[model samples]
Target: MLRVHFTAEDLARVRVAPGPDPMWEILLSLHVLRQRSAAPVFGPWRTAVRATLPDDTRWLLQLAPPVGYSPDFLTPTAGSCPVDAGIEQVLSTPVASLRADLAQLDCPRPDPRTDLLAGGDTAALTALGDALHAYHRHALVPIWDEVRAVVDADRAVRARSFLDHGCEGVLAALHPTISWTRPVLSIESRFPQRDVHLHGQGLVLVPSYFCRERPIMLRDPSRAPVLVYPIARDVRLTCAGRRSLEALLGRTRAAALEVIAGGCTTTELARRLGISAASASAHASVLRDAGLAVARRHRNSVLHTASALGVALLA
Candidate 1:
């Protein structure tokens, strides 16, 4: 059990990452590569990557175990950071911090790889960086387009939950294993039990594509506080799902209906569809007439929601 202490102001500061962090994806994907058999969600990815696990990528295996602590240097505090930005942050880490972070990973036996990083060997560091880049490009890029779509969908739902029910609502729906009790938010880490006293820094909630059930957090609290949790494992615009959606509604209309399922304003729908508000409104009108969605006036904005028919169509 992990207890996270929070202040009143902390709740106000709570935020979800607007997008997936590339570095976090790399770190999590490494774990998936090592332990693909453990989670059914990664089965497809595992088969795909097995075809070509480059020899250079093995360097990453030394640090990323199927089950264990991850080096802090690989995970930066920023909500949205490019792969290079994160790699540069790791390279710039103080030798003391690197060694300290590596100390936690000395469990099964002290890994010799730690020495190279601890001693500030630029060659080893550069090689690690290169490995990460190659691994991400080879393994992740192919699926990234769909991956981003899944992540965006998750964020869309989370954002709606935040708007409708506030921070508590967001936390309530984050994951089944996580629970919030006012001042303290408890997470069933299922790891060695400990308490995280935020003191007041609040928490940054990040949604990850490759993360599994148990939520992940920064090992060093002295740094920025963050909790990286898994996005919906089954959420994806698969060829089957896409075809089904299109079958129920035409291709272009299916796209519009899919976005409407998340409950968006006309302006939001327009922006998402890359069409004028008038055009978006016209589509919404069609969906409304077909009993697939309902548009309700809320203040100055019209919010569109998927009706039961729409829900059944998607399900």
Candidate 2:
């Protein structure tokens, strides 16, 4: 479990990135490109893009393997800039930071390019930037439309969640593998267990169409914390999916479903709906019994989230 500890200030500053970060998409997509079974969602994309990747991707592949550490400088600005601007940021990495980042590589293959990069060779840095630009052109630009569409749809869902339930709701609804419990948000990852302390520099949640089942975070803690989570796949949304609240679940019960869809504590549900706590509990009980909602005990409260069926109903 990777636990991110948040201070009060950190909690207040938590936010979703406005849109996809091209650099993040490029880095994580490398992982998918190198995998044989890149999950069902990405298998087809991988098949199509693999044949077109530039031969010199090793400039980045040497650092960003199929799995494990990638230099933090590669994604210096997260969602702050476009690919061209982001590439410049990578090229401008401070010499000290570059050397320190390169030294931490795990089992890096014997490559003179890695040595040149660690020594802050301007030519090597330009080459690295060129490799990134080439890879993005060949692999990401063609599928960029599909990537943006999925990420935007995911953001819409999260935006509704934030409006309904605030930051906690947005955190809780991030991913199934992620859990938000007051001051701590835990994520299941393939990396070794660790904790991140966000004293004041809040976390940036970047939704990536290429991020796989497990969320990815920077290995170095000193840099601004970023959690790149996978966007929902093939979420079937239709006008017919939005049925009248009074029809099947009744007015109040359906209202409860809507609130829970964004995720909230029982007390929060009661407060939002202007109902007594007991009433909220009873409605939640009925919903849980019918598999419309699911609850998890966290600390002293039970956090409720709409189940897949409940989300489908609210679609």
Reference-based lDDT, each prediction: 0.76, 0.78
Full-model lDDT, candidate 1: 0.76
Error of 1 at 48 (Å): 2.0
Candidate 2 lDDT: 0.78
lDDT of 1 by residue, 1-315 (tens): 888888887888888887788888888888888885745777877877866889888767768777878888888745667778887887888888887887777456545555788777787788778887898888888877556655665676777678788898888778888998888788897588778887777788888888887787877877888888887664544333444434446666788889998889899999998989998898877776665666645437776767656666778
What are the TM-scores, per candidate, against the unseen true structure?
0.78, 0.73
RMSD of 2: 9.0
Off by over 4 Å in 1: 107-112, 240-315
In model 2, where is the ten-residue run with the lowest total lDDT?
Answer: 236-245
Candidate 2 collision pairs: none
lDDT of 2 by residue, 1-315 (tens): 899998999989887888789999988888887777785767767887777667887566667777777778888875636999989988888899999988877754647888888889988887898899999998888766556644654666676577768898888878889898888999997777899999899888898877878787887777888889987665322122334322336788889989988778889999999999999998887776665666655437676777656777799
Q: What CA root-mean-square deviation does each model show from the true structure?
A: 7.7, 9.0
